[model samples]
Target: MARFFSRDRHGRRPLPSDGFDRALGIAHRWFLDRVGEVATIQYVTAPADMDWWRKDNTPPLISGGIGSSGQVALTLHRKFIELKYSDDGMLPERLYELLITEWAALTGKDVSEIDPEF
Candidate 1:
């Protein structure tokens, strides 16, 4: 079972010491295995003070940004992940699909090639 940490003295939630790291590793390996070396997959947590206004109306939890190298940079918000996990409703498969879909778009790869079940 995954363990989550409570808010610290600063009243900010910190990611589980290993949960996000493990999830990111799994996601990286999944991308490498499914899509090969065409692009790099990275996970970033939203800063506590990040301005959502600049991000448009999209929920901060599942959004992607482009990198200097034209690679797809997926940012997964930790707060949202924790909320979903705590509710026992987190679906990693859904997140994977989102990432894979964005990757396909960015790399011009067929989404079916990355996830046949999509």
Candidate 2:
């Protein structure tokens, strides 16, 4: 097998030639392999640049997040197959709004009365 270098050497994985869906498939499969279905994925923090060749000798993480505290994470890193931990938290405002709207539509509830959890 040939090696593939990520476009951002010190950051996230390079987009696979097949595109975002394929990349999502890869992440989903990896997530399934570890914790099972219904686990959430998070982009913990942004990656830093340039200093990859620095003295620390650590490969930059793609995203790091959860642990034995009932939380889990799946990460795709600068190098493939590096795993880390993260926490579950409030959804972003846009996502929350979208989910709320979708939830209202799906369940036949008024949008104002739908209080989404997670």
**TM-score versus the correct structure, for each prediction:** 0.58, 0.30
The TM-score, computed over Cα atoms with residue i paired to residue i, of candidate 1 is: 0.58
Best candidate per lDDT, number? 1
Residue-level lDDT of model 2, residues 1-118, one tens digit each, is 3444436646777653423233445545543443243434433233445465356765444333345664544343422222222211211233334333443454466765544242
- Name the regions of candidate 1 deviating beyond 4 angstroms: 1-17, 53-58, 65-68, 85-91
lDDT of each: 0.63, 0.40
Compared with the true structure, the alpha-carbon lDDT of candidate 1 equals: 0.63
State residue 30's C-alpha deviation in candidate 1, in Å.
Answer: 1.3
Worst 10 residues of 2 by lDDT: 82-91
Off by over 4 Å in 2: 1-21, 42-55, 61-63, 67-69, 78-118
